[model samples]
Each structure stands twice: as C-alpha cells, then as structure tokens.
Target chain A: MEYVVQTTNLSKRFGKESAVIGLDMKIRKGEIYGFLGPNGAGKTTTIRMLLGLMKASSGTIQIFEKDLNKEKINILKRVGSLVENPSYYPHLTAYENLEALRKILGVPKTRIHEVLEIVRLTEVANKKVKGFSLGMKQRLGIAASLLNSPELLILDEPTNGLDPSGIIEIRNLIKQLPAETGMTILISSHLLTEIDQMATTVGIVTKGKMIYQDSIESLRMYAQQKVLLKVSDSEQAWRSLLGNGIKADWEDGIILLSEHSDGKVAKAIHTLVHEGYSIYRVEEEKRSLEDIFLQMTTREKVI
Target chain B: MIGKLLRADFLKIKRKGLWFLSFLGPFGVIALQMVNYGVRKDYLLNQSDDDWGYFLEYVHSFTPLALVLGIAILTSFMASIENETNAWKQLISLPVSKMSVYLSKFMVLGSLLFVSSLLLGVFSLGYGILLNLGDQIPYLELLKYSFYPYLAALPILALQLWIASVSQNQGIPITTGVLGVIFAYSAFILPDWMIWKWPSLMNEWDEPLINVMLGIGVGTLLYIVGMLDFTRRDVK
Candidate 1:
C-alpha cells in the first residue's frame, strides 16, 4: 500500500496536441515497475514530468510520499534517473565522470569506486569516455545514477542501442538491484519482451493514457486467449471461416482466432481442408504481453 | 554550507580546464604585447618621462582588450559545458539547492576572470620593467588599477553567463557574448545620458575600487535573474 510514485490526472500539452493526457498511476516500493508502450506513446514525456525535468500541463505527482513540485530537492535526493541517451563528458575518464557526479551530490569518494565496481567498469575506469562504446557509456550513466545509493531508480529505455549480451547484462543488473538493495525501479521500454523478463508490475500506456496496470500474473490470468492458425491463403481462409460462423482476424497469411472455442476451430479447419484449403500450421497460442497490449490499444483503432 | 557547493563548483571548473585558459589567456596577451614591443624597440627605448607616460598609456589601453577576450571565452564556454554534456540533468537532480547550482557556476567563472585580470596587471608591470622604461613601470600603481577594471567586467560576465545558461546552445552563448563585448565598446562612445551603466565600458583601470563595487551591484542583480531563469527552466 506504500506507493513509491503516484501521478494523479497528469497531463502535458504542446500547443494543441496533448502529448500525455489525464494519466493516473501508482508504483509501490521495492518493485520493478515496467512502462510499456509503442513509439510516440508518451512514455518519455511522463517520465520527464515525474523527474521534474518538465512541468506538467495539469495535475500532480508524488514521489516517496513527497509532492514532486513542492519537495523537489528532497524527492530528487532519493531518486536517480537515466533519461534518453546516456551522456557524459567525453574528455573525462569514466572514473572522472563518476567523480564529478559524486562531487555534485556531495557523496563520499568511496562511493565512486563502489559504483564503478557495480557497473563492471573498474578496468576502464581511468580511460576517457570518448573511446567508450555505447554500452560502456550506458553503464557509466547507470554508475553515476547509483552514486547516492538512491531509493528510487528511473531508467528510460536503458537497454536501447545495446548488443544482445549487453542487453542481458543490463537486464540482470536491473533485476538484482531490488533484491540486493530494496531500490524501487521504474523502467520504460517499447519492447514488451524486454520488460517481460524483469518487471514485477507492468503499466501499458498508449497515446498518453494508461490502458492497463497490473502485476504480470494478473495480466496473464485476465488476458484473452486466442488460437493461431496459419493457412496457405489467409484472405480465402478468413472468407471461408466467416461463412461458417467463425470469426478470424487475418494478419500476414495467419488467422488469429480470438473469442473462439476449440470446437469452433475444429469445425473451421474441417471445412477449410475439405474445400481444398491448404493448411500449413495450427496451434493453441499463448498470449504474450505484446498480444495483450495490441488487443488493448488497437481496440480503439478498430472502432 | 556554501563551501561544499563552492568546492563542487570549483572541482567542475578544474575538471573542465577553465582555470588553465584563465592563466593562458592573459599570458598570450602579454606575449603578443612583448612581440609588439620587440618590433619597435628602437622607437620605444630613447624616451623621457613623458614618453614613459605615453608607453604607460598604451599599457592602460591594451589591458582592457586582454580582459575582454579572457572574460568572453571563459564565461561563454564554462557556462555552456553543462548543457553541451547534458550534465545539468544529472547535477541538479542531486540534493543540492537549485540556487546553489547556478551560483556555483557563476562564482567559479567570476573567480577565474578576476585571477586572469590580476595576472594581466602583474604581466604589464613586468613588460614595463623588461623594457627599462622606468616611468613606464608603475608596478604598485598598475596593481591598484587592475581591481576596478576587473570589477567593471563583473556585469558583463554575469550577463554572458545568463545568456549561456538560458540558451543551452554553444554557438548562441558565445556569439551573444562576442556581441555583448561589441555593444559595451560602442556604449563607451555615447554621451553620459545615452550611456547606460554598462560595466565593461566603465574602464576603471585607473579609477578607485568604487567602480568595482558598482559593477558588483549590477552583476549581482544580473546573476540573481540568471539563477531564477535557470530554476524555472524546462530541461531537455
């Protein structure tokens, strides 16, 4: 019941278009809260408002029980964030960058070496950031954010522009923080697969409105199941199945049969095979976060 | 405490090498003047007290030019580095007060510019000594002259810092700084009524430290506005 972050009726507007609408959300302590959305879905905009980087057009934000605007310095002291690209002074060494951050935060010098070890940048700590790869910069950014051993860590697409192994490393690093130190994390990413592995709770926002917010278990339990069937001719199969009282959603030669029973699938397949409809594949489909997200967000588009 | 904030600000300045340029800038100017003196050695040597007066006059004239270049480059670049590296996003997110963050940067840049002017005064005295121009060498007098002229630069430094912090773009801050210097020079030609209290144009090199006090007043006002502007700004 102790929410680490809460935004009530939060909104942001640029000229006429509302980048983020009336969004109400809550994130509890010691949890990996995943914010999933498509590109241009206002994920970054909301993060910026929450971090006090930008003013909200309307409504309020509360972090760690402190009002964001009223207690900015207090809230920020307990919060660490990596927004957009990981940036640092390219001429300064990795250690130097961390040192600069530590000085700004008034943290002890010992914390610099501790964070460097945490990010696994000890060997290259003295090397200038100019020659560092994309992953190295991200790790350094992460190290800088952890300088104060913050209670809340907000990461916006931290795994973006990383190699496969780098992505896994960052993912594992994020997963370990909550258990190891009890730091509540808010991670935003466009890819559901990325959040699926780590997040304890997930919030799916599309076009600034939070459409779904629940734990992974609840999402899976409440999520609609569908049978996926791939046919030789998706358009023809859909047409044939429609005549037999079977509703099929066709996408790229695959018929996604939602809101349909297994008996309904059997009858449709029987009619398709007899009518010389080439059946390539048919399987009971497991609904991923992507499927649930698409169903939730794309429903409006269909209407 | 202000000391911790000042230390943090100074560390940033040291890391960025702003202090080095403060030393290097005035040194470069003295080197250029020495080279100029070398080319006209025969004309400069056979001179009386009146001639020494004329040479001293040239020292007075050239010192402001040196201060101009030093302050402009130092103020513009130092203020923009935080923006160029997106460092402010990380910096202001710390436990430090927003006002402290703004003041820290302004204080460090102001401190460096003052140090540069002090070096120029010492170098000018040395330039006179090396030339054997006895009357031209007003070592104690030159030291006295440096304070007010450096103070006169305070308002300009404050304004340039304001421009740099608000814009968050390298070219705009530096370009605005160069234009501000030009405006200051032009204002000097205007009548007393038309001439606003543009500190850089005051030229208090030979005047009392009173002008420096006045410059501090105007500069403090500009610095306050700059700090407020930063606190209200929306960071990208």
Candidate 2:
C-alpha cells in the first residue's frame, strides 16, 4: 500500500508522564483514516508530531516516504492540518484570514474564494471572524486546511461544537474528499459514531496507546448482533445444541448463539423443536459500536 | 518566504493600533518637550549657552524611557496577536520554517521601532526650528539625539521580544517592561552592563557610539538565542 503517513514507535513525554507512547499509525492514500479515542487520549499530541508542531521524544515519522526530521518543510508542503481548537485571527475577516495563509501557501487568490465557497462562507467572507459562531469558525478552519489543495489533510475533532446539520455537512464533506479529489484524510474524534460514519480505516487509542487499528468493517465485526434463544428446559436444549456441533453459550437462562447466520439460526431452531423443548422467544441482540469502542479503550487491550 | 510572512504579519496588525502606537511614541516624546518649552521658554533658554544643545538634551532624557516602554508594549502586542488565538500551532504547521517565523516577527518589530525613531528626528527638528534655538541648527546633534536612543535601545527590543514570544502570560513581559522603564528612568545610577541602561547611552567611557555598538552586537546575540529557543520547543 502507498501510505500517505506512517510512524514508527512515536512517543512523547512531558516530564515523567508520557502523552503518546509507541504509536505506529499508517494512513493510506485516498482513505479517510479515523483516529478515534476518548478525551485526553493523545490524539492532538500525535497530530502535532505528524505536523512537526511538537517534537517526538522517540520514534521516526515518514510522510511521503521521507524522514520527517529532515524533510519537514518539504513534507508539510503537501499536507494541511487543523489541530485542536480552530485557529484564527478574530480581528481579520474570513477572506483576510485565508488570504493570510494563502499568501504563505503561494496559491492563487482565486483558490481562496474556492475554499470559502466550499465551506459555504462566501456570504460572510468580508465579515470579521470575531462575530462568527462556533460552526462558522470551524468551517473557516476547514477552509484554511483546503487552501493549499493538500494531498493529505489532518483535522483534530473537525466537527466539534457544531450543530447536527453542520456536523452532517462536515462529515459529508470529509467523506467526499477522498472520492472527489483523491485526498487522504486523518480525522480524530472522541465519538465513535462520528468515526463509524466517516472513516474507512479506524485506529482506536486510549491513555497514550493505540489498542485497535484496522478497517471499519473489522471493528464492526466486533459489534455484530448475536442470536438469543429463550426456551423452557434451556439446560437440556443447550446440551442438545452443543452435542450437534453448534458453538453456543448458556447464561442467565438464555442460549446465546455466536454463529448467527440465517441457516445456522434456522437449523438450531429446527433442532430445538425436534428435541421437544418449548421455544418461548427467539430474538437478535445487537452490540453497538459504542460498546465495543468503550470496551477497547477502557480495557486497554489490543484486538 | 520571509517577504510573504512579513506581508501577512503587516496585514494581521492593520486594526491593532500598532501603527498609531509607533507614531504616538515619537510624538509623545516631542510633546513632552513642547510642554517644557511652553511653560518656561525664557528661564530654560537662559540656562545654556548652546540653546539647541540644551533642548536636544531635555528631549534625549525622555527618549530612553519612552523607547523602553514602547518596546515593551509593542513587542507584547505583537506576540499577543499570535498567542491570542493560539495560532502558533497553525503557523508552525505551515511549510515555512520556524526560524523564518521568528525572523519575520523580529523584523516587523524592528521596522516599527525604526519608523518611530525616524519620526522622532523629524519632530525634534521641526520644533527646534519653531523655537528659534539659534541659526546654527545643530542638525548633527538633533540626528544623534533622536536616533541614538533607538539604536542603544535595540538590545531591550530584542530581549522584550524574546520574553514576549515565549511567555504564555502577557503580564510577565509587561512587568519586565515596567521594571525596564524604572531602570531607564534611573539610567545614571544603573550599572553600565544593564540592557535597560544601554538605551540611555551612558557608560564610564561616556561615548554614545559605544552603547550603539553594544546594542547591535548584543541585540543580534539575544535575537539568535530567542529564535533558537522558540524553534526548539513545541508550539503549544
């Protein structure tokens, strides 16, 4: 895979406490990589290290296959980032704010208007940012990140403090970038649902460590629903199902079936009916991604 | 890159009142003299055989204090512009090197102080002509007095920028600046090695040129140290 961003054993320490420890992040080209963690999970710290805003205590970061320490300026040329809070000069107008960065990026003045229109701030382009709402400021930050037409964009909590509609707008925007422009994105958020909706690749971190890194589908596999059977004489039914080579678990007077395919569930039901057990109820119980995310982060176990 | 950064920085400070402060520092220094000459024109004129020299001396006395306080406020204001929004992280993330960012800030502040000094020279000469402090205008002396304090104050400018850039709290630099104004006010009693005393252009050798040379050399050294320190740390 052609990775847009890769890190090896990245770590950062402030005095005796480690903020980020042994993080190996791989962000592939043209994929929205979701960096998911709870608050204070060192998401911002790792993003800072990636952007060269903060030095890593120990590790190597390679962007575009070049060493970050030696080629930071060159690497950053193709990368755009918005870390932590949205950074802006409230005194400057929205156009002026992007113009300030556009000057540094050396992009055309027309590019500024394009990004403003992308963020839907064209009407307020001439107004000072101090009076802007949180969502407007966030859109401005996103607009600034896109000013360079970067190949790789990193945003920390991009939807933070936005209303539901605004969140959906940003989420759709992020989802479209990889397809529309072939841009690789690394978006960090504390909400698992947000990541679930946007990221193709997911990396879960908690307390300075990455516990889960894989495709979003694999993470969802952990959240797959299971078949639950409630029947009279459940103990006998469980043994009977076990003797038939079905993997099952009996807990609290209920039979739990992990292999919950339609054929397996139908066969189990048929077998239970044949064994003369009265089937009272059969239902599927779902494990949401939030549960899996909470378990992974709180347990600090690699999956 | 430095040029672009400078242009962007100049744009950032447009409504910040920095330009007014730059113009005001020199005008206030000359305005103090206006009040002095306005009150006792005849009495002050009788005190010195070199009337123009005496007027320039009185003007020079307040120059160091005004320069020191001005440097404090201006440098702090420049730093707060970035620190206000925590824009350092965003700025450092740019393709430009952190060294260039520091250099741009130093250059901007340096340019502002230079303009203020130029205005002081002009204002002093205009008021001197109005006072009729003799036909021998002492143009060289006027130039020396107006520009020397600014040159001698370079080290203080560099030191304040260093402190203001690194400090998260504006109060720290402001407090240091207050102490600096005190030192400049009592310049005669201060030791020669003090950065604050350099602005007064005083030393045991009694050569204003010595202070100018020390300001340039030490100012450059302090600037390098500050830039190195700024680039070494994390943006937050």
Candidate 3:
C-alpha cells in the first residue's frame, strides 16, 4: 500500500482550455505504471507537474511522501524525468552532452559510461548529437535520465522514435529496471499495445479525464470476451440459458455468452445440450488491448 | 555545487564561437587603431601635447562600442544555445533551483566579457609599443581604458541577458541588441539617464568614474530584477 507518488485534484488550465482537469494519480513502489492516453490527453502535462517543471493551477502533489511544491528540491533528489522532447546540445558529442548534465547532478565520471552502456550508445558516444537519428536522441534522453540512479523515473514517451528492435530492447530494459534496481517507472504513451506487455497497472485518460485506473488484468476484462455458439435451435437454447440463470444474448442466429471464465463457458454449453440442442461450433472472440482502449476512451466513462 | 554548474556551463559553450568573438572583440579594436595610427601618425600625435593621452582616448572610444556590442552578441548567443537545444527544460528539471540557473548564466557571460577586456588591454599595449606613441607606457591610463568600459557596460549586459533569456525568438533579443548598438553609437544625443548611454563615458562633470559607479549600481539592480523575473515564470 506504499505509494511513491500521489496527486489529488491536480488541474492545469491554458486560458479556457482545461489541459488537465482534476486528475488523481496513484503510483506505488516498484510498479511500472503505464500512463496510457491519446495525444493531448494531458499525459505530458501531468508528468510536468510531477517533475516540478510546470505548476498546477490547482490541487496538491506528493512525491516520496513529501509535498511536491514545498519539498521540490529534496523530492527531485530521488527522482529523474524526461519530459516532452529529449533536449541535448547538438554541437556536443553524446558523451559531452551527458557529461554536462552529470556535472550539474554531481554524479561520478564513471557513471556516464555506465549509463551509456545501459542505453547501448557506448560505441557512438563520441559522435555529436546533431548527427544522431531521432531514435538515437530518444535513447540518449533515456540515458540522461538514468545518470543519477534515481529511485523514481518518469519517462514521457521513452520509446517514441525507436525502430521495432529498438523498441523491444528499451521495453526489456524498462521491464528489468524494477527487479534489478527497485526503481518505479511511469512511462506515458498514446499507444496501448506498447504498454500491454510491460505495465502492471494502468491509468487510461481521454479528453482531460481519467476514465479508468486499475490493474492491467482488470483492463483486460473490459474487452469482454464473447463465446459464440452455433446451435441447431437458437431460440430454444436461449430460453434454456435464461431459465438456468445464465446471461445470454442472441446476435444474428448464434447464442452469445460472455466468457468471464472457462467455467462459465462450460456451464452455458452444458445447459444448451441438456435442453436437447446440438452444438456445432463454440468460437471465442478475444479482443486486443487496442480494442479495449478504443472502447473505454470512446465511451468516456469516468471511473 | 556552483563550481560544478560552472564547469558544465563551460562545456555547453564549446564550439559555439563565443570564445572566438571574445578574442576578436579586442583584436578588432586594436587592428582598427593600427590602421588609423599607421596612416596618420603625425596628425594624430600633433592633436595632443601628451602622446599617451591621445592614444588612450582613441583606444578608449572604441572600447565602449566594442564592449556594448559584445555584451549584446554574447548574451544572445548564450541564451540561443540553450533555446536551440531545448536545454532549459532539462536544466530546470534538475535538483538545482531556478535562481542558481540564472546566476550560472550570468556568471558565464560575465567571465567571457572579462576575458575580452583583458585581451583588449594586451592587444592595445602591444600595438601602442609598435607605434612608439610615447616613452611613457601610461600604465594607469591603460588599466582605466581596459576596465572602465566593461564596468560602465554592465547595465546593458544585464539587460541584454534578461531579454535574451526570456525571449523564445532570438529575433526579439537580437533586435533589442541592434537598437542598443545604435544608442551606443549616438551616446552624445541620448539623455544622461539612458542606461545604454552609460557605457560611452561621456559626462559634463568630467568624471568617467561616475558612469562606472552608475553602471555597477544600476547593473546589479537590473541583474537582480532579471533573476527574479526569470525565477517567477515557468520555463518554456
């Protein structure tokens, strides 16, 4: 139940546009919390508030059990962040670019090489950042965030410009961070599928509102798997299911039952057969995370 | 901690051509003098009974002009380096306070200008020796000409740094800088209260030290005001 970060009623307004409205975020220790939302859904804004880069128009933020506004310096000592674009001096080599930040953060010189190795940029560390591809810049940004060995790392679109293999590499690296170093990660992205495999908990935001926040397993349940059965007599099978206290909906000629569990599917199949109906095929339709995300956000139900 | 911050600030200025301009400012001033004195030594020397005094005046006149323009370009370049790379967000999000970040920038710019002033002294002294302007080196006059303009130009430096730091578009800062240079060029017509006119060392009281004193007092005030303004706003 220990939380590393907690926000209550955090909001930001740009003139009349409510960029982030009354957001309540909770991130526990050692959890890879996926802040899932579409573009302009206030993911970047919320992260900025947490990092003390931007002030919240209203409400309070607590980091490491200290008020973020009152104890920003002390709180930031244990936190590292990469917000919006990964900024680096293009004229400087990758090593020098990181070296500049290292001097400010006061980390050891050897730590620079360690972070370079962590981001797999050691070979090209001597090259100037101006010549780097977008993916390289993104990786260097992540490497800069790790220079301090912070307890909490907030990454805004950490895998933004990476190729497929680069994405997988960063994903695995992020996945191992908690186990290897006991660091809590909050990575924001507009793509749900990207966070599907890595996130233990998720907060889905849409149009400045958090529609859902819970374990990833619970989010999967939102997809609502449906078991479609082809039966000899569909109406009679539906009637039998209704009488047996099973929820069944008829769509086209097939009997559709929600697959909450395998036991539920078995009971529905048994009841149809007990009513003397021959079943031909029982097909299960499983929805992906993308489908669930689209459904939840489109519905815009406040959780 | 400030030392570490300064070290990092130095790394950022690498290959930015600010250092080259620092050397160029003094070198250019002396080079101009070389051409002037070389072509008309008799006319220039005859104008003043004191040969050293005349040479010092000529060298000092351009000192204020160069110092003023250097302040403008140097401040704009410093801020542009950060803006170009979007380093403000990265730097501000660090454990350091915004106040220190402002101070670090001011210190770096101040140090660069200080070096340019030192170079101006060395180059002018070397060129005057080549011209054989006087048997007396006029060491005290040389020191005044080397540093007085720098001290008097402080207000402009502080103001330019403020504008450059706050402005997102370099055009805004650069435009103000060009206006400052023009004001420096027409310092005689500008009112005595004008901050840009302070660097020109022209006064009815015949006290060059008055402008230097005003520059220090006003410059410190402007720097404090600028730092507070910078700290009060959110980093872009």
Which prediction has the highest lDDT against the true structure? 2
For DockQ, the strongest prediction is 2
Per-candidate TM-score against the hidden true structure: 0.83, 0.94, 0.92
User: lDDT by residue for model 2 over A135-231, one digit each (tens)?
Assistant: 9999999999999999999999999999999999999999988899999999999999999999999999899998889999998887889999999
DockQ of 3: 0.79
What lDDT tens digits, residue by residue, belong to model 2 across residues B1-236?
Answer: 99999998898887999999999999999999999999999999999999999998999889999999999999999999899999989989999999999999999999999999999999999998999998998888888887888888888988999999999888999999999999999999999999899888889999999999998999999999999999998889
Q: Give a tens-digit lDDT track for model 1, residues A64-165.
A: 988998998888888998887886877778888787777667788999999999999999999989899999999999998888899999999999999999
Question: What lDDT does candidate 3 reach at residue B28?
Answer: 88
Measure candidate 3: CA RMSD: 3.2
Q: Share of real interface contacts recovered by each model?
A: 0.53, 0.80, 0.83
Score chain A of model 3 by TM-score against the reference chain A.
0.87
Candidate 2 regions with alpha-carbon error over 4 angstroms: A228-264, A272-284
Q: Residue B166 in model 1: shift from native, Å?
A: 1.7
For model 2, the local distance difference test gives: 0.93
List chain A TM-scores, every candidate, in order. Answer: 0.80, 0.89, 0.87
lDDT of each: 0.78, 0.93, 0.89
Clash-forming residue pairs, model 2: none
Chain B, model 3, TM-score against the native? Answer: 0.97
Rank list by DockQ: 2, 3, 1
Shift in Å, residue B82, candidate 1: 1.6
